[model samples]
Target: MTQNEPAATTGDQETVALTRPPTALSGDLSPRSSGTVFESAEPPAAASGGEPPEDPPSAPKAAKPPRKRRGLLIGALAVVVVVALGATAVFTIEPVGRVFGIGPSAVPTEPAPDPIDPDFALIPVDHVSAGPTEAGLASALQPSVTAAEVGTLHAVIVDPGTGQSLWGNEADVPATPASTTKILTSAAALLTFPADHTFTTTVVAGPTPGSVILVGGGDPSLTAVPEGTDTLYASNPARISDLAAQVRENAGDIAITEVLVDASRYTGQAIADGWDASDAPSSYGGFIEPLMLDGGRSDPLNDLSQRVGDPALEAGNALAAELGATSVSAVDEAGSPADGEVLGEISSLPLVDLIEAMMLLSDNVAAEMLAREVAIERGAEPSFAGGAASIIEVLGENGFDISQLELSDASGLSNQNLITPNLLGDVLSLAAHPADESDTAVSQQLRPMLTGLAVAGASGKLTDRYPAGASAGRGWVRAKTGSLTAVNGLAGVVTDRDGKLMAFALLSSGTNATVARPALDEVTSALRECGCR
Candidate 1:
């Protein structure tokens, strides 16, 4: 049997057809068409009755057109071409964009070439040396200076730009900085707050119409008493008086029978943790409360009887009296004014100006208040801890190495506070020449500091020390004086013989400050006579 034939079955016969229909190359094929016919060309097959002729093997359909192969090759070549084009475009565009196009303008043109003179290039603090050479100021003061003597002397002389010790007996040691601490507080204040910023004291109505509360915002310079009046010592604070007048004006037909002062903003803890309990509770170490009016005093003139209690309550009482109210009481809670009207509000000096005053007078109270303000402004815990932390942050930001420095309070009241002369000098330099010129807060606020310094025996604590004369520091030295029992400190700017401004700090501990003042004055005289040759 042929391969195409099926095996015979007993009861049925079946035929299998294996021929496939011919496919036209383009369109349908016709019998009369000119195309070749496979049937006429084939040899005759055996008759159906005879043994089936051996079926010839059919050839595979014309091998499929090479279209698929061509398509795959074209796709591969297209991908290659695309890749080449992209690479060429990138290579051609990059250098052109860099050289001709605006691309950051060649590393910023070297920062406008700093205009510092080479000869007067102030020595940087880090590179200062302490050897015994003509250029080394520390060496001149070392041989005659003893560690014990170092702690006794107050004045120190050094280059503001360089941390080098020019001539100081106890330059390396730490001493009570007194109001000099205001410098740090001012620095931190300026850095944390705006220059034009003012402290607001609001007189808000209490829960009842007849009751008004005085809210203290720690404004150290607030005053209700007139300047140069005997009643100034007995009268109420200025802002409080204004608020009372406003209430009276608003309550034209009505009468305020009761006034309550609210002093609840600050913590009850008045004295700092490290403060000496034995020390007198003078106005300088005034109570620390949130609602203090006129800096926690009933009168600015007399510190002895200036009633120290809840400040807000005092203010409220004063306002009540001024408003013709019959009753006044200190309230722990806040309340609205009797007339439901806002009384006149008073603001303390700007932070910069306040700082300046604090610096010049070396006022401990101002320094403490400023420190608290700085703490509050920085969103830190509003206490001595917060103040110290704020100071460290400010110093670090201004490029000070505060690793060896320790501070407990802004006034340097605590003996625990310690700082080296080098660090102090560095801070002075920064204060004198702040990195950010736009920031005038510190410079403006530090005016009081300069005014507070002993003007060559002109006034304040230094009135008798550095007398104005050819032999004394007349106009050559202007500095802040610090004294705390055994601790003595003097830090400020002085103009040398060559008219160069220099900042210095001399701190002494473990000696009588009164006795050390003369020696410190001598040191200042030496610096004025002998320029840093």
Candidate 2:
């Protein structure tokens, strides 16, 4: 890589002769040079098979060999740049000053496109299977559960490749599902509704003039992103400001004075029966109301922030503020106007987006609303109990067994909720395998759950769970996480070392979540490393 030895031609490079030799400028190196002294010369010596002439015919005083310094100064010789790759050397040169006293012009070229940054780094798209033995897989995973200080733990690992059980330890028993219940909730929602279905919110004329109702259709993705800004959710939901503008437009010659909210699409207790008192209004859980902003998050943008006590009333109040109401208007329940005079309408993000958000963030509020949506679709009451029942009904109809389950709430926030590792595995396996099985329609729809599950050490709830000890599974394991003070679960699909997809469920109880979560994570991590054939 060193300079070409100043034309000595060292290393692997050969010095290419300059197409034209350097010549002294008839004039000085400044302003004008077209009218200086001139000299006529013969072809350069290199082309004539001889050395440079003793002196140009018109040199200032050259009849004999010129002085060494004078020759070097007069003809510095064009610099020829050489580049070598392996045994091949390429030479290039930029001719400056003059070649035969003529200046060379550079060719014009198109500029390169500006490089744009990619959203995320590319990861391995293809998985290679090591094809390990199944009996060996069971032997390898059995101890992660049996050797731990964890109590009341159950685990099941099944290869999605052959629909065969690879490992299990008390896996058929029902245990607290924690937030993992959202997985079932998500599957049922996708099963009962179209992937593009959106929760609808409508604004209609109220019972009296100068009044309007913001009818909540359970669109939890709604946000107040000003009149023309984007929301993090793909929905681009109905904004209260937009509704207010429409209300103003319809009211024409008069200023509307009041705004009301109707949140009756879902009817039931705001809180599930078996939920702990502290669960709601906490950072992780919220009132299970039909209408809420940003999943009832007090901060609207922070998923882990505390929730409001009455999400519906808060939403109504937000609408009232947006409408510039002088006084707080009492919210009332009412259907859309009988005359079909609608002021505004907004649809939540497509149902698939809600499922992804629920699974990625383990969003309890979104999960509950989706469950109720499932209930509504199934001709059942849109309540917690009804939603849970509807999920069971939908899953049972889709070739999954729910006989050993008790789902008190759709969110799995209730300690009373129970689910078997076997069901979890079966549900997950449904997503990994083909759609030609029974309930083909349902299975096809449920396949999106695979994408919704957070990638290990990469996204959503599972982002921070896979530490260095589990580095082997990073970007390889995909799973949903469940955690309460004493309950922890991890269940999802993973491509085993053998490249065969595996569905696993690890539910543990009677241990601190801090300890149980990592232990369960280790179990899934084991699946990623297992090459069971």
Candidate 3:
């Protein structure tokens, strides 16, 4: 039969295709030798009764054809194709094993990651450490003064590098900071406003020929002193005299018959809501108005004056009178002058310098004026309320926490204002230096302002306070002095033995300022000498 034909075997009653067999199959046909006999003829009838079966002799089993090598070769080719297909699927598919029936363990999986602790992730541990200990620098400041006096004293020294409480009683308590409050105000102002900002005072032509209206820009430093009256502007007063003369000169003998003063740039609101009504108006406690120039006029006769009676309008009028002007009025009702001509104009010292003066001398009128001016610039009402809101807004933008702070006015003239030492300390530290390495304007401005402060046993209100060698500190303490009826405070930078600068604030409340001043000075002196260890 052909290779494609099926064959029937007697021993096994199954059809089999015998085209090719394994190479091991033998070619010899010795069927009789084993147990069965294979013949070329049909088998004999069983008992003579069966007729002889006739069938063509099955074709001699073709030599179990030489074992086909092609079968093995086809199987090997099929295996190679399957392996290649599996590899292609694995390379092309994202998650390969799921698409085909292959070794599952061969697939790779990303291992689970460790979870993070939220609390530990948020804390900033760069500069701070654990709580203060008795054996540390804080313990060195332990009070030697008795408890009876301790309750009346708010004294403490601190290492600015570490927030360690060095020494004192009632250090944690809040107290009226007095002029010390200016530190906070100055820092906030400097941080919030640009250093080169200049305040404008315009001179517009009035209705009358040769007459000009001096528009107030809340410039407290406007001066008219001829050449040399004094080195400082505070001592030597200069008004708008030269400016008006120049205006007259430009106008060619155009007599300034009527000079109208415009003081409407700022809102009329002066004193803050929380200020006490009974405080002396001359004591720097009077509410600050935007229009009243020169710390609300130091003269007593000027009813328009808010603090000392000397009104900036009066000063302007005096300058005009000296320059041969007919009249001067401090009325805010003047309309915009006619466009006759533009006259001379003067600008106030840069905002940075003004702020430094305010901070160093603790000038209440200047501080209040600046606060209101800031409000006006921001397009808000130039009232104390508006100023407080603006200050808080600026502080918040700089990442400060204003929850515990209360600001009724820019100057600490009002007993209603309250701030914590910690908060003040934090602000001072950040603003102590300028942000740009090349610009030392802030530092230079701060130097002049600081010189205005009352030095111990030298100048200002502290002319004769601390004696030499109070506790190991002498001639080394330079700080701002604060005093109120029930509050006294001293806060500033002190250099230790190793030349390390340390910033500290000591505030005392519910005590006599006169009695507490010495204690505060003593603590400051002690810190200066590194007596607190």
Candidate 4:
């Protein structure tokens, strides 16, 4: 499932105090048009008939809704679009959310984002009994392995409750993981980067007087979202207008003659190797640049919107518009500032939020950006080769076997990438229950990964799944989905009938998603229903 095609085209609570470069591509990416485009749940400027809201409310509000992010909100919307008996019914999720006053949208003014805290209260495994006997579990799952199971399926189920490998079938064999590779990218990111990490976009005095440079700090959340208006993608963005205001203050009357975009932080080709040329500017696939607005979306609000070919330039234009500069002249590698004085800077959301967005939307560009951020953190070159090498290095440092895996790109957009189901399940196990329970440090750090996996028939990639036979897993199974022409996979955690937490990874090849998706869903469904005591 090269995410470049279906991925954007696609969290948890752990309260670890997090703060750093802050950021949004948004909570969840809505999949629409051509199968590759996506949009976060940002507020549209206008309403019905492009009209404004009936009236502005001048009242304060009360009530705290569930902690909402783009993934959660979009996942909830997916539930409504699907599974609802009344398909033609017209309704709005906002009013329903407002009645309860759960999210930021409910507030008249957006409240400052709360610090990173995953409040990890996953059904405690202390007293939970082991899952069904291996034999019984095998019997339960055997029905799901139709003739389709021949030799293409590689799967693993881990019962974290008992800390045992519950099942495996060719699980250790590495194969093309498709988008399931994001699990590795995200895990490595969380393990190494701070809980609250952020990418920064800065405005520094350029090499010459009267020249202003907008340096790309690998911040994609920087957006064209109008002032005071918020979108999921721009929950907390580095605004060009803010930069403009700061520059105006610093340079008394000296007019800014030019706005230069500094994209020197990243090196290598804009598009990654093994990627389709069309994927670079596709709604789902965007060039890997340090600076992009709304994830390289031209419309800034629609995921299906055309992607700008030169995001660095588009970003420069956005800043130029803010500076009141009629047009941007050119883009060049920015030289060191003459003085150390910084004109202005804006930070992205912490690393936690970015990781959540990546998992929720399966954002290929976001995944690449995060991996590059990791590369920067590790002092590796910030490119696909560097990111791929760094992720492998980080995973090896953390004790995962590096010998079994081969990675081409961070977002799992490459058909050449190979990973085993065993590693996938192992990663999920680490996210659910770490090496040290007494310290619980790993659990605290990796908990967000669990929170971000798609819920069965409920959210994210699983939204349209589980409509009927797999209903047992609805809201019960939480995992990631991977699909390519002849590949399909699912990986994530789920609480079973015994209330036991389990991690599972199923990677299948030689079959289309239509045939393999339901078969894999049935496997998770079997887990949810199996109460073998």
In terms of TM-score, which candidate is strongest? Answer: 4
**On residues 209-250, what C-alpha lDDT tens digit does candidate 3 reach at each position?**
756777777776665545443212233233466566667676
User: Can you tell me which runs of candidate 3 are displaced by over 4 Å?
Assistant: 1-136, 144-174, 231-239, 278-280, 283-287, 291-294, 297-312, 331-341, 433-455, 459-461, 469-474, 531-533
The lDDT values for all models are: 0.47, 0.59, 0.46, 0.61
For residue 316, model 2's alpha carbon misses the true position, in angstroms, by 2.1
| Per-residue lDDT of 151 in model 3 | 39
Per-residue lDDT of model 2, residues 1-533, tens digit only: 00001121325322221110011222222111111111112222211000111122344233222111000011111111112211112122122111111133212122111111111111122222334476878776776666464667887887554556777778888988877788899888877886667777777777777677777788877776575544433324557677677777876775667766677788887678776655666656777777778878776544435678888777777777877765444454455465746877766666766676667656777888888888988899999889999999999988888899899888877778889989998877766653222324545676656656765544455544445333345445667777654677778876554445677888887876546656776677676666544
Report the Cα lDDT for candidate 2. Answer: 0.59
- TM-scores for all predictions: 0.64, 0.73, 0.64, 0.76
Task: Write down the lDDT that model 4 would get.
Answer: 0.61
Runs of candidate 1 with Cα error greater than 4 angstroms are: 1-157, 161-176, 227-238, 278-280, 297-299, 302-307, 333-341, 434-454, 468-471
Candidate with better lDDT, 1 vs 3: 1
- Tens-digit per-residue lDDT, 56-103, candidate 4: 223412231111101112223222111111111111222222221223
Two-way lDDT contest, 1 vs 4, winner: 4
Candidate 1's residue-wise lDDT over 74-114, tens digit each?
00000000011001100011122122122333342221111
After superposition of all CA atoms, the RMSD between model 1 and the true structure is 42.3
Model 3, position 272, has a per-residue lDDT of: 64
TM-score, candidate number 1? 0.64
Which run of 10 residues does model 3 get worst, by summed lDDT?
71-80
